[model samples]
Target: MTRHAELVVPGGRYVLRRARIPGCFLHAPSAFGPADADGSFLVDLLIDNGLVADISAAGASMPADGPAIDLAGRQVWSTLLDVHTHLDKGQVIPRAVPDGTLEGGARATIADRQFWTEEDIAARMRFGLQCAYVHGVSMIRTHLDSHEHLAPRSFQVFRAMRDEWAGRIDLQAVGLAPLAVFRTDWGNRLADLVLQSGGVLGGVTDALGVYEGAGDAEMDRLLDAFLMAAAERGLDVDLHVDQTEALDPFALPRIAAAVLRTKFKGRVLCGHCVSLALQPDDVARETIARSVDAGLDFVTLPTPMIYLQDRKPGRTPRWRGVTLAQELLDAGLKVAIGGDNCRDAWFPFGDHDMVDTLHQSVRIFHLDQPFSRALAMAGPMASDIAGAGRHGRIAVGAPADMILLSARTLNEAMCRPQADRIVLRRGKRVMDPLPDYAELDALAGMPA
Candidate 1:
């Protein structure tokens, strides 16, 4: 079968003709009938005024007043959501190289901060957002480093871009501050900025030991301050927790306990938590139980973790630097996987492609036992965690945010390069030109 070129809907009602979307992909189970002998069912989707108005059996009579594009049995899936990414620091590789350690990456990133003009940050962030949009991602939540000197400028650029891309893609920001700063005037200032820009409060848990040299009592004080501030400001909290291989001084349980004690009403999301994988089975189970009790959500960024964890010069690594995702999911916690960094100083690899992240996650986390569940790590589950509860699902009355794939099966969808895919935002096909690397380089004041 020949792939269908993307149909540009020129802003109005339209009908997707004879599309064969999978039953598993539908939000409503009854939308599609049982598959035929070839494991496929044909349907027609009517999208009107930026919503799915109707879905009927294939060849059903429908209005052809607007335009009708034949899908030719191509599979349709929800566009992806990325809950954890570093847009402020993306696409700055080779220019700012890390020494292949987490500490080294932090140092290198801080050193490169001298060159972070607002224009430079905006250009790099726009480049990453464009890549994500073309790759069929409808929403993203990026973390911006929130030092006292840098955060105001970073938030300024991010807020402007949030408006700039409002219709095409939803952008949410998190102020990635250090926990040690939470009790200081600087922390209050950061909270004010976050509240002004409608962003979440974020911090690094592992940094308590590495950067601040904070012991147990001090860690508790810092965490309490952070949670209290977030509660006072009515903001959600997203934390980078236990991002190291060391099993001792585990911060996940402490964080969960703090959330419960502080009675934080907003959502609490924890990223990384790699040390959970190294814990004894019973201890890990207890930690998961605590997290569930505290109403915590998780996002695992396997690519960066795998790149930075368990690495010593000229030696084979012992463990993959990822969290216990399977355990968390099996325990009924909401776990999502994300593409953490794209071409950044910290582990220089990744495009902002959630499909690629899902494919890799299926391998790294052993998620292919049941294909549908594995796919959810990047789809509906991730969308819900990103606070886009109505997106990443196809149903009557839902926003027409979807992707048309050329593949017939889930395996094909994961394995094949999706070059021929068409992305839709609010029922309209997105046809923005992909950004050129040379152009981005020029914008960043780098040689092409």
Candidate 2:
């Protein structure tokens, strides 16, 4: 397959004939149906230059000008998007592993910050991008810890990499500070820095980041200040909200109310919101409704949230720590999933792979009841929320960045880790190898 794909590399057109794609991701109104039980059907994808030129029914003509790679009824998915991550904190394993608690994670990370030189950040960030690309992720939005002193250096490294990796991986960053930072003058400086760097304005409203806990009224005021700060800058807002099990600090509702009252015209996306699920059914429903009215978007980090939530030293976890994804998705709101933390203080087990993230989420959230819709949570849904253009679909005009799996059905694909899957960036197979862990020894506090 590699040699065949390589033969057509230079200014060529080819037909990936008879490939299976989900009907939900196909663009043509013409319909490919008689879909398989997994909701995918066979289609002929015409790849020209670097775009999916056209998609036709199975019997469509294969252009004589180019070679044909018969997919043999294998499944193909759009190259994934991971809308939430902490690339700046990636790959700090032994030195910073969390003790299976939220505050422990925070303390470990805050302690780890003392050693974060620009060289260290760039190394980890670069390694993370390599893992993401080899795993077929073409776009990522990472949260940079922006607490005054760290903001300049972190964004400096990020700006350099965002340019360096262009045309291979689309990169975006958000400034993540605690919500209280907004009330202080330093928060204004951070927001200004985010604007200058072409990054998003972000903060954590969860119990972990806030200083002395406050009641609903104080929170409403703080939330309003944060929303207005972003509004004043004309920047999009991405927040970590309600990530704790404690129901007292529910910023999901306050964020929605603040957006409405302040008329924050920019896009507002709230991640986590785990406490929403623990709220009374009426309260949760009302919050969801208000969030929808305020046009709030959501990105659920199932893997890391599972690890951080419901943890006890001796007892087994009784509840799955996740957002109300099903209810929120059903309500016409844009709900996406993310790889929140990878090999860092927050969670220790990830390779920057969204396919595995989606697969794990299916088992945890039962997202596979309608397979295509669930798949979109990591693909098109995440891309749409991140404003990464149309790269996440199998439509004619979409970029031909795709992952071709050997398996033909969902069960076959999900049953194992797809270490051998082929990644295509702009119609050609990407041949870059994954980075090795030995490269991070110096930063991870390993002995020689």
Candidate 3:
């Protein structure tokens, strides 16, 4: 069949034989081939007309009809989902590299926003999307800076992109602003704009610039108002909460309380929560339990968390920092890991690669004992959090978009970036190379 194991699909239909897939990525792993040591099982995927026709046990039957890509036990993953990212801020490192701290990053970003004309934002964002797609990421939910003046420009660019990247990469936008804004008349307008653009209602509970600690009655009022705004419009909410090393700014529990008290209907997504790791066990447990009771979803940005949470001039960090992902996952809340920022002031690193994001997450969150569940954070779990379409899992009759890895085991896949990995869309090889950073040279330089 077709030159002995080469990736050549005949007429948009073929069989990917001897393909290894992680158990967690499959909807029905029990019915597949026997599991290997790392929980991956071999199976043959029959792709027809851009959809998975069937997944039979490896070598269950002969493919006497058409081309068969003999993968020879290569690992396969469903195209990934990235629930939290900053596309508006992506690729700005050249102009806005921060001092590698949250405050510095925020200040640098605000300074850079003065130059975010629609053309500049669109070019950088389009570049980010191409990078994500080339690396096999199928769905992305990017949080846009939704200040009154910036919202119009950023949301407009995002709306155009959400339509343009419609089929290739399921793009979702979340209007990200500070919690205090929800109490303003402009906040109502912002919510309306988000609704008009089909975007999520999102805010940072404490932007560090405004510390809304627990027991702050004003914080509660603003939060409840924010939730109500989203609820009335049938919109989902995502918030940046507790993104600091200080123990006082405990906004996550407050968020959970607001959600429960308001009985908000829309799905809630909370990001960062880095300070949760610093809380005492009892406090952390109670907060996590409340989150579960409120049915809240979480996204951890480990890459940015570690870089920003513990940084200081002379002293080394007392403890490694990130959100309590392990505990949240154990509590049965939908916890996902995200590439929070890429080549921006936030982290000044990353290439919009969700696979790399997942790889970083496994180490940062200690999710590799199984690695399958960790993979799901960037895959199915992420899709659920973003409310993006269900391309995150490999299922019967699912789109044939997936990544084929030369590594058969999770360890091998994790050892390196898996640079040799091949991305396939609609069961065919994607030949679009990752975008070069030089393409955005015109958009570089600080505003006068």
Q: Where does candidate 1 stray beyond 4 Å?
A: 6-11, 17-25, 35-42, 57-67, 208-211, 443-448
Worst 10 residues of 1 by lDDT: 31-40
Cα lDDT of candidate 2 equals 0.86
Model 1 error, position 5 (Å): 3.4
lDDT of 1 by residue, 238-322 (tens): 9999988888678999999998888888999999999999999999999999999998999999988898999999998999999
What local distance difference test score does each model get? Answer: 0.83, 0.86, 0.85
**Number of the top-ranking candidate, with lDDT as the measure:** 2
Task: For residues 1-448, write the lDDT of model 2, one tens digit per residue.
Answer: 5432333333368888779997666665247647888888888888988888988777766575657777878788999899999999988887786898888898899899877999989999999999999999999999999988899999999999999899888998999998888779988888889899888999888667774587778777777888777878898989998888988767888889889999889988899889898999999999999989999999999999999899998988888999999999999999998999999988988999999998899988888788777788888788788888875777786778899887778888888777778898888888899999888887745455
- Provide TM-scores for the models: 0.93, 0.95, 0.96
Off by over 4 Å in 2: 1-11
Clashing pairs in 1: none
